[model samples]
Target chain A: MDLAPPIRFELRRGAVTAIPLAIAVGLFGVSFGVLSASTGGMGALPAIVMSATTFAGSAQFAAASVLAGGGGPVTAILAALLLNARYLPIGVSVARFMLGGRVARFVQSQLVVDESWAIASRGGGEFDPHRLVGAGVVLWCAWVAGTVIGVLGGEALGDPAALGLDAAFPALFLALLVPQLGGRRARAAAALGAGIAVVLVPFTPAGVPIIAAAGAAVIGLVRR
Target chain B: MSESWAIVLAVGAGTMAIKAAGPVLLGSRPLPAQVQRVVALLAPALLAALVATAALASGQQLVIDARLLGLAAAAVALALRAPVLLVGAIAAAAAAVARLAGLG
Candidate 1:
């Protein structure tokens, strides 16, 4: 973890936008918490702790589906691995900026996410790994907070939950995704993954098949 | 212990391992620039792919639906280089209206 003194100074100077970012992350977390319940999550404790520790919202959602459906460990692991393979690149990209030793890089790796990637990739400035740790911790907490509410308060959703409120996530993720569209290969791969997932959803578990489709698309890209 | 937690634990462990690979492997050696550029684009590309997967669904053997409509609307907005937020709202609105009209 990044030390308190310097990261605190950075926070005081307003170089970090932890609060807004955490709230934004909180929305996603709430949805996932509701999702955990919808997917038959164990209890608030397990659900919240899962969100806090894993810190990958999509993977957590996907995992919920897998566990709900009585999927095997291999299926869960493979699905999580595929869903999170995107992080491999995030790790590599952030690796470019670290001036610290092995321990620092290791910690920074766990904290890498959409916001951290944005912060790190914006430029090579004075934002240290400490700040990144602080942001990750906040983001993780926001997600956990949302999970707690979602699990405990989930029964309150009633009709909205029944009406497929989970669709909101795919919609939200899609919105976050549209702007970055570029190049033929990338377009092709995206199309392939979506196509396969849509086609395969009925035959397989809800989120699992989609992730499998993503793996297939990634393989195709790797080959190309 | 929820089964979901099991999956999360597995993912957390997997993510940490993937995150540690490059830095630990290189050990103070700067990576090739070409590799860096490629790595930079990987997350965005995968995000786009996952986004597309999230948006569309296949019903009764690839019938057209609101998702396709939303996708097309999103495409037009995108071609005009609309802001990301606007494009998403426009496309989603178009799709939602169509679905609400019982067209999905």
Candidate 2:
């Protein structure tokens, strides 16, 4: 099938749909950049490069916090790796939509961040590859741009907390989640997941709680 | 400094590998039915988990603070079917005002 026009439409829709998320992600990136500059021993180039390459905010934040606290490099990297392990399942879930040849698959896989994944998965069973890629590109650009701005204006940006941008991340996620809670099963799964995460927050490492919460989806599978 | 750089490089490489693992291993094969159902549910589950943690916790402990109020405002905005950007803006504004009022 000729997938061009549909892909194009989805791409445009995805980019437009992602603007808010891109903005929130940009703010988060700015916070990371400022923190990296101040305490992570990361200069502007390294900070930009990390944001561009890793493109994962929580992992970057974890690594930066560890480094700032004088933790060893190995320890920081390990923490980041553990935090990022959640991507493995996300990648698997999105793999089918990563259409095309080996090269295309490899290239598209790099765009698999949380926002893109969430947007792409919202298509109810029909995963849209174009939407995923389009959202990924916009988010990547926003994140990189935000990091550059933050690094250059590190001191001027001050603490993102003061501006209350720290709340933006959760706000965006909650917004995305509300629309998905339409069905009883979905609501149950989400409630279970939230409960698991809240209970584990004080016990587990930072990212582990979320990954563990992903297990709550088994309720959906069991009910099916 | 070099150690920091090395750590960054290692993390970059490690994260890339993790991101690539699913596509590399799973390929284009359709997931099994039960797995597919679970995968379908993963987004809502993981996202809710993230929201709970992000809004309520700071470091190791859960805090009742401006962030909670901001989240509540954002929830109201979302329930009203406001645009995603507006929801985030409302949340941020609510938190900022609450903080200014020494709420947190």
Candidate 3:
């Protein structure tokens, strides 16, 4: 067994590092809550519940957007599924690091979000499960809490776009993406992924292009 | 059940199931060599796609708007090795300012 630090230490480290991201996520969650509340179809209770349970920002936003546009639940669900398909590969990447039995492992796996996973990654397919869980917990709390605030009193906060919160998501992702583009293969995948997404956006439905862009990563399968 | 409740529950369950599928099935087993290679690249590819979609696309139309300014400002911040939070703040400020100036 690898002599790792105690879980608490790693967890604290994860939580500490994640605090900044968590604040941003909370702000995004506020935007989501405000948007969902403004949708007219969804109430505060359901919006909060969605944030608490669904816990995926992009997917939740897509679903809410569908509802806002007067689309039915089926369309909303499909859109969310398209956005969430990335989790399948993400989960597989982190599986070997996950510990515990069936139930425990499953609960812990709930912590596998993009931010948490990135924070936990130690490169070359190694992941620190405790850190993943830690960061996930912090972010989850922030998301849910922010949603509650937004759902309860979002009207007072005024428009999120006016505050430029919408730009935060792209910026956060860009920050995360830059560090990963250190190698030639990663840079190639990023360029390919961005191109695929841009090319497909006009033709495909929302979220579809994003998942389809994952195919760009297959470039890594080529012999170097 | 109400339609809203149904949507919420269905989405919640579906997302949870999707999130659990890979970890539950794979357990602690190591990924195969080819899979590992691809997996390593997945973060970069997916993140880039997210950045593009979030920054450029609005619904079906790829509009050139304040978000582009935000992204450009973010790129500058990243080049300067700014912290993540600062990068987000700078990007948000840039976009908000551009929008205030009626540029989109």
By DockQ, the better pick of 1 and 3 is 3
Clashing pairs in 2: none
Can you write out model 1's per-residue Cα lDDT over B1-104, one digit (the tens) per residue?
54446665777778778767765556555557555444534444455545555555432143556666676776677668765446555665777677677877
- What is the model-wide C-alpha lDDT for candidate 3? 0.87
**C-alpha lDDT of all candidate models, in order:** 0.58, 0.85, 0.87
DockQ of each: 0.32, 0.78, 0.81
Kindly report which residue pairs in candidate 1 clash with one another. Answer: none
> Can you tell me which runs of candidate 2 are displaced by over 4 Å?
A1-3, A123-125
Q: Tell how far residue B61 is off in model 2, in angstroms.
A: 1.5
Q: Which residue ranges in model 3 land beyond 4 Å of their true spot? A: A1-5
- Per-residue lDDT of model 3, residues A1-224, tens digit only: 36456988888778887887898999888878888878564778898998888889889989888988888889998998888888988888888888888898889878778899888877655788888988999999999999888887878998878778888889999988887887899999999999999999999999888888889989989998
Error of 2 at A214 (Å): 0.8
lDDT tens readout by residue for model 2, A52-97: 8998889988888888888888878888888888898889888887
lDDT of 1 by residue, A1-224 (tens): 36567667744333255555465457667766776676445456667877766677767766665666677656766766766666665565566556578887777677776655543343221234555666676766787888887877776755432232333434444544453345555456556556666666567544444445444334322534
State the RMSD for candidate 1: 5.8
Top candidate when judged by lDDT against the true structure: 3
